[model samples]
Target: MAEQSSPDWMALARRGRRHRMIFLGTITVFLTLVSLPVVMPYLWLLTMSVTTLGSAAVMQVFWRAAGLVAVLYLALIVLPPLMPERFRTWVPAMAAAAAVILTTLFILPLTTLNNFRFLWNPDVMAAQQGRSSTIGELPSIWSAMGNSFALAGTQTALILITATPAAYALSRLAFRGRETLSRGILLLHAFPVMALTVAIFIQSYWMGLLNSILGVVLVLTTLELPFAILILKTFFDAVPWDIEMSAVTDGASRWQAFRLVVLPQVSGGLIAVGTFTFLRGWEEYVYVTTLLIDNSHMVMSLYLFWVSQDAMGADPNLIAATGVIYLLPVVALYVFAQKYLTQISFGGIKG
Candidate 1:
């Protein structure tokens, strides 16, 4: 072989860059295509929530919102790199403001909140039926929302209360069967709790918690414990032992050291676990439906289900509005907890 005289480094770099660009482009296209099926329904739900199901305005608003999101995404991608490092942090906020302004100008005019009248209108089905005939009336949306909040909130509290100590023990203290117990907890997480619904229901009934939000809360918390413990233990493990030892050496009890020192260190993990636990309880439908016999105990999930069940002549807009409402809390939680949530990793802090 004629010794390759002076390899073209520039050409090789150009080729490598081009290949990376192509690969990234292909992956982006694949992801967008994959996401469309999952995303389009939510877009349609949001559109129908604000506009009549068959109205032309529905499509108009959809396209406008989609266009705005696309533009905002492009701006974040393109503008951030162009900005100085000090100014990069402001790009997201600026993009969000621009999006809001554009939405107000283009999309707001085509949208209406009439479909969400259920918020103030107690008897939605009755109002729709003009009280002359009835397809039966359930509790008010407020009642359902209240119950959902109570269930999710209580479940989160229970998970935090129980999982914290268990995780700390698993992470710090050494004892016989400790390793086995940790593995056992992880194993339990793999078991599908839904498969044990009948047993859970029977147990709830026996405990006199049937038809009660407390029953659902307890059930959800129990099923959630394994996951919560596993996640929290990883956080506890990430806590440096020196910090705890120093605290202990300074005359602090182990519980005191954990409560004050280790606890704050793992705050992100706790929030991550709690956020997921709350969302699980919030969106849970099966257990809530099965355990509770009364409409008064209906959760947002069951409420949305009932609203959607009016297949014969139910207003699709109303169902969509309910869905949008049901989604709001989850969206809000993720938005606020995004910082800590993103830091959660399998075996260590993301940073």
Candidate 2:
């Protein structure tokens, strides 16, 4: 019997046309949803800054940040169309990095003209003109950044060590009540993380850890455990049981098989997990706010949160500038992990 297969280009093209319309509609909706988070805050910030100075005055900090990102995006968009395909990707990334360095180290300090200073210096006015709003403090922002990096580094190391064994057990070995344990862990998210931090605060106070790094690490470790387990377990499950059996057959111990083979297979997943934990720990506000009551223990999120709010009424500009700096390690971690994000697949059938 002869079997007819597939469709001709005309018929295929008709189907493709229908799907293309649906895809375009879906993309429009998805893009709108995705853009809201970025847009709403900036809108509020724009309104706040403009209204503060009355009449019309430029906000230097926002302009500089927007300008830098805009230039990078414009370069990336235009460079590919004009340059050779071979030079497309690497050239844009290198140029963007150089731009970022220059913006931070050189251009940023020059942009800090206060709105009140308009009458003071005619040259500062001529150089910046109506385009000058005082830039935020650089020194305090740098201190916040140093604190952010330190906390992120500490949290990454702790997450890798603890999450690996816990995830391995969940992935590899079935024990009584294992399902119940996993379910409980997932259900923990039902309690608002912020509420849990409040309870942790009370506990930390009683235990005399309220203003210490240990308190911060303990809170982060607990918060990150469930997510780490889920990610690592998925990666470990993708390893074939037959491979482990064969290793056993060749006199490789289970631990040896895991160390040499299994771990290597899932290193990318581990990195992703570590990066996730580090970012959460570094940027988390509720836990740090409740647990760390002193200047010495302040991480960037708490610091920025306070600074932004006027912290019982302080400096709003300091907060805004610090918040931008606060986002760096997280951005860096994502960029690094994205390079090694490979998909592994599994099937019951094995050769």
Candidate 3:
């Protein structure tokens, strides 16, 4: 009898390839659908920023067309894993490049550039001259921005200096009431800020700290301190004591060992703490408004409020533009600190 024919390997391989492509296509379509709701509002915001009228007619025509084009382009890039073997190798790289370019385009048009243009227009500025409108009498934008930076930077520095040592002691030293102290810190952090606002104000008034940036910074630092200490203590606990002791045995003092060895080990935690403190200071509104009654001492948060309620009155576009500017720094800070943030862990927490 004739030998049985060998199995058709190429046919089986082709069948497997076809099944894989079908699975990938289904996933790609599902992801695209899931992401649309999340992405559409941002597209509308971008459309409003670039054009004077975000009318329904314009949105339906222009925005829809642009979105369809984007979807098609994304599909073309994402579906390449189903392509021939030689081309599949480049699919991931191509998809990544496309993602970066699209993200930049989406973000660039929504920045402060358009706001600056409208704010500095010759006609707009001239119209405001000697006018009694609220917008006309607003404080300088540059000044408010400067105040925010100064307050945030100073508060972050102070928190870092104070919280680091406190965290180290809590993590390394055995002292009376140490566990109670940790519990108290967590409880204090959870305490309501609004509930204590009146007491804080009265204390600030008695101490002559009201209506000053320093006063605002001090309050923000206090609110931020408990969480900072908790996070840093966890970071310190994660660091192995053996390496620190080794440095001590090499003729280094305890302080020297900590500075040279342990500190570097917790750099990620330091970054996470600094970023949290800075953002809290930067976006502070309740304490700032309640404590700083003077209009001349306005930070960006208060300035934005004034612009919305008093200055730009009914102009939603101007408000949205300002809101974009307000959000950008926070976005940038998180983007920069995300890697360090992921390094922080609560795995070492103890009862």
Per-candidate TM-scores read 0.89, 0.67, 0.75
Q: What RMSD does each model have against the real structure?
A: 3.0, 8.5, 6.3
Candidate 1 C-alpha lDDT tens digits along 276-301? 99999999988988998887788899
Residue 12's lDDT in candidate 2: 88
The runs of at least 3 residues in candidate 1 whose Cα sits more than 4 Å from the true structure, single-residue gaps closed, are 1-27, 77-90, 129-136
Clashing pairs in 3: none
Q: Which candidate has the top score in TM-score?
A: 1
For 224-292, candidate 2 gives per-residue lDDT tens digits of 777777667777777777888788889999999889878987787777777777777777777666676
Q: Which regions in candidate 2 have their CA more than 4 angstroms from the true location? A: 1-11, 14-33, 36-147, 309-317, 339-351
Least lDDT summed over 10 consecutive residues: which range in candidate 1?
128-137
- Put down candidate 3 lDDT per residue, 1-351, tens digits, no spaces: 999999999999999988988888798789878987886666555545544554444354345546555755564657566567787777667766765676466644433344446445545423433243534345566677889999999999999999999999999889999999999999998998799899999999999999999999999999899999999999999888899999999999999998999999888899998998899998999999899877678898987786566334434555556666677789899999988877766775232
Better of 1 and 3 by TM-score: 1
Error of 3 at 109 (Å): 11
TM match of model 1 to true structure: 0.89
Order by lDDT, highest first: 1, 3, 2
For model 2 the local lDDT of residue 101 reads 97
Task: Report lDDT per candidate.
Answer: 0.86, 0.64, 0.78
lDDT of 3 at 289: 86
